[model samples]
Each structure stands twice: as structure tokens, then as C-alpha cells.
Target: MSSKLSDYDYPLPEALIAKRPLPRRDASRMMVLHRDSQTIEHRQFRDLKTFLRPGDLLVLNNTRVLAARRFSDDHGIEFLFLEKLGPARWKCLVKPGRKMRLSATAKIDNVPMHVEEILPDGERIVALAEDVDLYAHGSMPLPPYIGRESDPADDERYQTVFAQTPGALAAPTAGLHFTTEILSEIPHVFVTLHVGPGTFRPVHSETLAEHPMHAESFSISKEAAAKIDNAQRIVAVGT
Candidate 1:
């Protein structure tokens, strides 16, 4: 059967939307829909450990969220880290797009960043002032739906415990549920996919095939890939 766009539509109550992370990472609820019985099982996320076996490889993105929000002259400007095009050169999405220009200066908590160049779609290439560590000075790149400034706790909770590479603009929400305890119980491998702003963008095409997927750079080391390929089963977390 051909799948139509309408067939994918389903109603979700506003109250069911998760506006914030659960108090405990593993405390969030999960709904398992069984196709054969047409039944839904509501369970806690931690229960996933009971269903998995040894040699099951869980693959997850370990890209760290960049603290890209900057404040300048009491005005707020948001920059989403896209990719590191070169040493000290990065592709980023700027907010209040009209105000940013080539050679423009932006400050994150007073740490200066110079706009090195501009790109298509109102994006900018920016370089931070020498010796400035962007991760230390920037704020968490929270999702737009949250509609609030990123808090200090977000710096830790928004990122996966295993995240090492630092370049993602958003949190891989599905991975956030895995705690160190859960990770120790199940074998997992990490890969880097510097997710850009496009991950959050709505799919615009009437047909799924017509929707363009934004290219995200990902890399898995040969050793990691070999482990994944040889595993008895694989589970992917998040987009």
C-alpha cells in the first residue's frame, strides 16, 4: 500500500507534550504500541534494560550541545553552531538576522565573537576572539518549543553523559534518558553527528519523498563500526 501524508497524521494532546525534562532521566514514561494486539503498554524508560540482551549494540550520537546564545549591548542574539568549516571558522545561524553582517561583532556574556563572513539563508561564519573558549562562555542551545532561556542545569542535563565531541546545536532527547547506570548495564557505542538547526525544522513537503533532509556530518571509527556490525542486535537512539 502507498503511504499518504494523511495516513501519518495523529492527534496529540497539548498536555502530553514534554515541556521539560523529567526530574530523573529514567523516570520519564514510555508507551509501547503493539501492532498485533493493538494494545499500548505504558512503562518507565528504565525498563528497557529488561528487554535487551548481551551483545546488543546501542548506537547513539555523542555530539555535545554548543552554548551558542550571545548577548551584546543588552540585546540578545542567538547563534546555532552548524559546522566547523575550518580552524577557528564555523558556520552558524544568526538570529535577528537583519542586524548581523560581515565584520559584525557579537559578544556572549561579553566574550567577543567576530562575524568573519556571511552565507546563504542569513547564516554567518563567525570567529571568536583569540583564547576564548566557546563552550565555557556560551549558553545551552535550548529547543524553541521550550520558550525559555537556558538554565545552568541545562548545561549538564541537556547533554548525554557520554557526549565528548562538542558541536551540536540541540540535544539528542532520546539519548538523554540513558544514565551511567543504564549505560553500564548495556553495551553501547558512540558516534558523532553534528546535528544542525534543520533537525528541528518541520517537514514541509506534502509527500515524504519530497521533503529534503539536511545533511548532517557523522563519523564512526573503524573499531566502533566493527563492533556495531558484529553485534547480535542494534538499537538507535534519537534522530
Candidate 2:
């Protein structure tokens, strides 16, 4: 069935959103839902161990979000890099799209970029003049709802403890609540699903069916797959 874009609209009060991560990763609150009993329980993230048994497998997405937001002072432009196309080429979304049309280019702080192609979705295939160190020069691409500029603290807070694989534009937020201590106590498998910019992109269509789903790259290790197959039940740790 089709759903209108407006149908998904709900008021998200700013107070309900978290401006910063908790002091400890496992210190966050957790809501436990019992399907059979139709009851709900509130607990700390560390208490997650109480709900699982020996044969239960916890699968976590270990994809890491890149520090992909960069500002160009020369042209007063901001680039949110999405994908790497080649050695020195990337797909990026440029702000002030109204002024920076096709063929526009910018050179900011010795990092040069040119618009190679304009995609149908309004993103640009950008060619870098040289290999740019996005991690060192760019800021974390934080969600706008957080209502603040990215900071040095976000470099570690926004990432999961097990984040090894990179390419995600956004972190698998559910994984953020876990700590090394919790993972050591559970039987777990790690999977990679590099989150895309679509995590923050709103559906523009009137019907949900008409909205195009964004694609993301993912991979599973043989060990993880074996663990998944051997487990009695699988518990996805992240959304």
C-alpha cells in the first residue's frame, strides 16, 4: 500500500533529541518489549545481558561513518562527500546548489574539486585535483536535528567501538550504545553495512511507494555467517 509523505510526519521536540552521547557508552537507557506478555520494561543498556541466553546470537553492524563534511572558504561552499568513484573522484552533494551549477569548481585550502557530472538526484560527480585527506580536513557529517556544529568530541562519540570498516555517511546509531565489555560477554557477529546519506534525507514523494530507496554497500565475513547459521536465534543489535 502507498503512504503519503505527510502521513509519516510527527512532531519531534528538540528536547527529546540527544545533543551529546552519554559519559559511558553502556550508560544509556533501554526499553525492553515483551511480545508475548505485552509488557514493557525500562533498563540500562548494560542490562541487555539479562534478556539473552547461551545460544542467542547478537549481530552488530560495524560500518563506520566518515568525516565527510568539508567547507570551502574560497567559494563559500560546503561539500558532503557520499561515495568514492575512483582514485581522485567522489560523488558529493554541494550546498548552495542554486548558484553552483554544472561545471562549477572550487579550490579551498589547496584541495581542488571540479564538478564532473550532475546527477538526476542533484548530486555531483566531483573530481579532485589531488588525493584529499577527508578525515584530517573534513568534519563529521552530523544530523541537522542535533542543532550544532561538529566538534572534536564527535570524532569518537559518533563512532561505534567496533567500527572498523569505513564508507558510511552516518553511524549505525543502535551500535553506539554498546561497549567492549558488553560485547565480550555475548556471542556476537559483526557485519558491515556502510550507511548512506539517505539516513537523513527525507522522502519527497507524496506516497511512500513512490520514494526511491537509497543503496548501501555491505559485506559479511565467513566467520560471522557461520555464527549466524549455527545460532538458535539471531538478534539484530542495530536498526
Candidate 3:
């Protein structure tokens, strides 16, 4: 009913948000809304089985969340990896802009990286050594919305049951609700779309079409593409 972005905002009490996940992956509650009846229902995520038909195809993104946040206290900056540019180069978002000048260099976990170039959007092109892999030592790049330090538990909780590629800065949060058993019981195919930094950017335009989009990489296998092409109905899970 409102076009103003600010008008769509509402108060979200801190307690209403679950800071940590339940011990069981599929134990979280799901809110279901029926369109025809204009009714709402509350149920566990496991109940999703009852609503699906035999021919319905579920397509899921299997991109794994990377531990892409590297902090350099000595430089007073943080580097959030977005995507790779080459064997050892990456597109990154740097923090405390004032400190990371065009030619700045830092050692994350003692792995050297340099700010090769600064983009118009303020992101940096960081170049690491040819044999270096900073993600192996960096911490999870948790969304700014989460207000706590990333811990070891996040290493597991932030990953999906079907994660297959290691490039997304953030997890497809919706995919985390599905357990291995649930996916096993469903008719599904996997596609990879390494979530990019843009996943966290909010829309700034008055309409969806007016918003500028950021780039992300995705892949679909020939078999998966064929299955999707022949499916009676398709459901893209965990957007």
C-alpha cells in the first residue's frame, strides 16, 4: 500500500529474533499463508512434506557460505570478500575507508594482500599471492544485521545441508531450514549461485524495476537444466 521505502519498515524487537539456531536443523517453525482462503497457518518446517505434490520439482542453490571476513587490527580495517577476479585476486569490500588507500597492503592471518584498485562503488580489487588462500583462515562474513561476534558454531550453523561450492559470502538462509532427510525425500535438483555482496544490499528505488542490481555467478548442470525444462511445476527453494 505504500511506495516509500521508509513506510515499509516496522519495529523488530531484538528478542523476537533468534540469535542462535535450534539444536536440530529442521526444528524451526514455519509460517504458511494460504492465498485462496486468505488464511495463515503455523507449523514446523518438517510439515512441508504434506503440501508438496509428486510432480512438483524443487530446485535449490547449493552454494556454500565462505568464511570471507578478514580483519587487520594493525591497519584498522576489515576485508569482506565478494567474488574472485583471478587465481589469487578478489573483489572485496573494505571497512574504515579512510585507512585503506589505493595502494594499501596488509597481511591477513599473515597472508599478504594488497588493494590493487578501488572501484567507483568503493569496493577494492585485492590481490593476494598466487598460492595463498585467505578464506582458509578468515572468519565467516556474517551479515551486518547480526550483532555479535562470529564463533565456531557459525561455521556449522551458517552452512546449508547441501552446500557444494565455496564462494558465497552469506548462506542462502532459507536453505538452512531444510535438513538432509527433507531433501532426500523431495524431488530436487541443485544449481549453484554463489551469493555475492549484493545479497545484503537493500533496494533504494521506489519500485523494484528501478533498482540497480549487483552481479553474482551461477551454474546449472545439463541434467538439472533438462529436469527443470521438463518439470510440471517448479519451486525455487530458499531465495
Candidate 4:
């Protein structure tokens, strides 16, 4: 049967929402699904290695989260830089799109930014001035569910230990539960998939088929591709 958007909906209590990270990364809860009997079990992240068998090629997304959230003035207007379209032009989503119509401009952190084009789905292609340092001025683009402002600590907490690439608008959050100890014990390789804002956009259409999918960039190395091809089983491990 084809799925409607409501088919994927389930009741989620506000109390169950985790607003902050645990003191230890590996201390988070893990839910295991066994295919043989169709069983489910709850465990800790520390037990992950036990679940993997020999010759399991663990694929990890090492795309790092960009400090993409900038404000016009004290969060009066939020500017989320989604992707760099050109040297100075960026694909972005501006809050209050009605106010910032086509060609609207603003000075954020002393850097001039202007709307170059507007997409029909409420995204805009914006142009930034030379030497605009988002890493220095922009805040972490935390999901709205977090319900708080991004702090300095999120710079470290939101990224994976193996995050070598720098392009994702949002974090590969599943990687956050991994620790150095766990990674050292597992057979894993890195891939890059810089997440875009569309990944988290809520589905408003009656059917999921009606949802407009946005593209995100990705990269895979030659050696990683070879291993994946020869592996007995491939287990992807990221959001």
C-alpha cells in the first residue's frame, strides 16, 4: 500500500524530547531491532560493537555542521545560509520571507548580504560581501525542537569526532552518540553528505509523494567505494 503523510505520524510527548546532550556521548540509549524474530531491545551505545559481526562495513557520514545561522540584529531577523552557490552568492532561507522580499538587503555582523533571487518554496539565493566569516559570526543552526539559542559549546558537541569536511547546514546527529573508544573498535570508513535544510523540513502535504525534495551534496572516496563493494554487509551509520 502507498503511504500517506499521516501514516508516518506518531504521538511524541514533549517530555521525551532531549534538549541537551548527555555528560558522556556513549551513555545515550540505543534501541536495537532484530530482523530474525522482529524483536526490539533497549540498550546503551556501549553495546553497539556486540551487534556488529565480522566483515560488516560500517559507513559513516563525516560531514561537519557549518555555523550557518546569522542574525540581522540580536536575532531580530534570522538568516540561514544553506549552500554556497557562487563565490559570494549563497542559497539561504530567511525568516519572515514576507518582509525580506526579492532584492532586500541587510547588514549582518558588518557584512552586507542581499537577496539575489527567491525560490518559490520560500528559499532565497543571497549574495554576501567578500570575506564574510560565518564561522566567526554565525551561530550553530540548531533544530527548532531544541527550543533554545545555540551556545559556544554546541560548536564541539554538535560535530562528530571524525568531522574533517565542513559543509553541512545541520549536523549528522546520529554520529554525536559515538565516542573515540567505540570508533577505534569498529570497522568504519568516512563519507561526506553535507546536509541541507530540506532534510528537516516538516512534510505539509497530504501524501509524502507530494513533498518537494531538495538536493544535498555528497562525496565518496575510491578506497571507501572499493571496500563497500567487497563487504559482506554494509551498515550505514548516520542521520
Rank list by TM-score: 4, 2, 3, 1
Q: How high is the CA lDDT of each candidate model? A: 0.78, 0.86, 0.85, 0.85
- Rate residue 184 of model 4 by lDDT: 93
Residue 112's lDDT within candidate 1 is 72
Index of the highest-lDDT prediction:
2
Model 4: how far residue 204 lies from native, Å: 1.6
Candidate 1 per-residue lDDT, tens place, 83-178, comes to 667666767787777767888887765667788888665678888665454555668877777767888888899998888887787877789888
Runs of candidate 3 exceeding 4 Å displacement: 1-4, 73-75, 128-131
Off by over 4 Å in 2: 1-8
For residues 90-188, could you state the per-residue lDDT of candidate 3 as single tens digits?
Answer: 888888877778888877766677788999978899887565676777788877777787999999889998898888989998899999899889999
Q: Model 4 clash tally?
A: 0
Alpha-carbon RMSD, candidate 2 = 1.9
TM-score of 1: 0.83
In candidate 1, list every pair of residues with a backbone clash.
none
Off by over 4 Å in 4: none
Residue 59 of candidate 2: its Cα lDDT? 96
In angstroms, the error of model 4 at 36 is 2.7
Question: Considering lDDT, which of the candidate structures 1 and 2 is the better prediction for this target?
Answer: 2
- Supply the TM-score for candidate 4: 0.93
Candidate 1 ranges with C-alpha deviation above 4 Å = 1-9, 83-89, 101-116, 127-131
